[model samples]
Target: MSETTNVMNSEVVKRLLCYVSYDTQSKDESSEVPSTQKQFDLAKVLKKELEEIGASDVRLSDHCYVYAKIPSNLDKKVPAIGFIAHMDTSPALSGKDIKPQIIQNYDGGVIKLGESGFSMGPNEFPALAELKGKSLITTDGTTLLGADDKAGVAEIMTMAAFFLAHPEVKHGDICIAFTPDEEVGNGVEYFDVPGFGADFAYTVDGGSVGEIEYENFNAANLRVEVQGYGIHPGSAKGKMKNAIRMAMEFEQMLTVFDNPEYTDGYEGFHHLGGIEGDSDHTTMHYIVRDHDAGKLNQKLAEIDKASEYLNFKYGEGSFKVVRTGSYQNMKEMILPHMHLVEYAKEAMRELGLNAKSVPIRGGTDGARLSFMGLPCPNLCTGGANYHGRFEYACIEQMELCVEILKKIVEKYAVKEI
Candidate 1:
């Protein structure tokens, strides 16, 4: 592990620790709007912080979203800009009782993660080379650090403090929002775009330090059900059908290369999720994604074709498939507003960082917001290895993220600043 830098002592890291201390993981099976009731724990904290920082019109929605505004100090008209980040962590790992360790001056050596006997070395993660001599905020090998989006939340909150403390910075209306349930694919389901009243927005939820995304996968959910006939062993010769085996067979129908492990960079994929069942019935879930809507449609059609073939072999009514549409590629919505992308690039340039506009393999709240007339794009949070135990974030990079956001506000909030 590296040495903990003084940057780790900044308000951004302090706010992040405060936010992650609460267990705010969203459940996939929950029918609630925010997916989990505990998410409001952090929502209330953020609402109080926003109000304390002199943010105007602060509101915490019943759905657990925190919205606030930093009124423009300038007299002229400038476009209202918004910054957003999610509050809930992923349910894949435990987020309760998180103990974040600060490692200062990483020495490119094996860093011990608590007493769990688990360690992080550059041998396993070559990207650690780039973080040499930097401070890192990591978990204790038992749970995630919640830096996926919490890092983003901290950065936005820090920027709000800066704007309030230094009114001489001179910027127009700055809108900030913190949402929940983004990890469960329902982050902005009830987000009121017009009510937020931002001409353009940015989701500070990307991985790595310099990632800026305008394109994302067109996503859809797939569900397959198998029905089987159960009979006594003595008379099971041809009367018995195993639903488990049918589900496994359906999985084999898809191309092996069209999965997350075998594809990257503009390539589409069909990812199979949890499968549960016995001999009487089986339920399987999948997610199909692609950069092109036409290709995404073809993937869904392929699932239908697989179902038809299974029905042919196992008799009709034996197999069933259903799909629900999720968010689409935001590239279509962002192309008309290239200035948003360019403005972010210019902000990074001002900070001596080259922002790369990469395509998101998964969906983001900004992608959904773009289609909803917000024209939002994604920015980096300086987090790496998200949604798992190995996740960690760079504190120096996070501070730089805060600076980049402040620059964006300074650039677009006024023509001459």
Candidate 2:
């Protein structure tokens, strides 16, 4: 890439491309905090960048969390605001050897990902139609682009750079953090929210340009295990009870209409994440989600009812269900601190962007942080179709996200809660 191209490309895009190069795909079921060691690879880089950008008290923790503080330039005391993003990518897809392709002045047509390979058409992804004439960064079909949170990271970094160059811009203290293993549901498992030193924060992990999320799913993981009597087919009369068959029956008992594919927009889901088993033993995995806590509990109870019925039919110890709470809807927590959300909205509006306050269908680190006394909401990073090969980020939109962050800081400097 020449200096001309570098100047032409947005700083957010450049930072995204650089961050995605380091493979930071987190591992599932790993006992470690980050679940993967390579998450620190990006953490160290972010620490160095923060220091270079004039962010003070920067520290890269042993668990791959990078924390920094930007001192206040203002005289009056105001609420210290924070910004956060995750370091690891989704473990469901490969985040290795990412080769990002830039599409400048995008035409409203089918976009080919690689030569003679996977393609993205406006017809298939109507969102692309809205991005016409914008610069997009996409990956080759083989790997994920990791825009999910890296876009968030770049936007915050861009804000740090802006704050460094322009000290005259008054603001209260700014706290920033980069977390790891967010994809594995342990984003802030060991996070020190009190030590982060922010009255409130925003996780720049939302999708699209003007999105602000305070409501998210009350999430939980469900597992069903089925036990079966293994008997030879020829000798099996009424003794052979196939566990896999039983597991299938249990899954069937759940309403298919409430699943991920069928539901959208504040509608809860009983997503069958995965299922694996044999004739002797089988297990069914699910992620139960709902914006309403009561509804989420009802979904879990329904799963238990299914398991109870199966056990009654197959005898005791034949079936078992396990439910583990992941994260809760942050709406209640955010309500008291609505000014934080308003600041983001005002910031976007100041930049001539229409801010959309939408409920996140999925959970973010901010959701958990809000419950943990941080009252953090989510801000967009200008990316769409995250966690897959088709994931892409709008370069111009991300630059706008950087501006939004700066505006938010300025808003806090002037406005009172």
Any idea what lDDT model 1 has?
0.90
- Residue 80 C-alpha lDDT in model 2: 95
**TM-score: model 2 vs. ground truth:** 0.97
Off by over 4 Å in 1: 1-5
Clashing pairs in 2: none
Which tens-of-lDDT digit does each residue in 196-295 have in candidate 2?
9999999999888888999999988977789999889999897899998998898899998988999999999998888898899998889999999999
In model 1, state the lDDT of residue 277. Answer: 85
Which digits, one per residue and each the tens of the lDDT, describe model 1 over residues 201-256?
A: 99999987777999999999978989988767688897899899888998899888
Q: lDDT for every model?
A: 0.90, 0.89
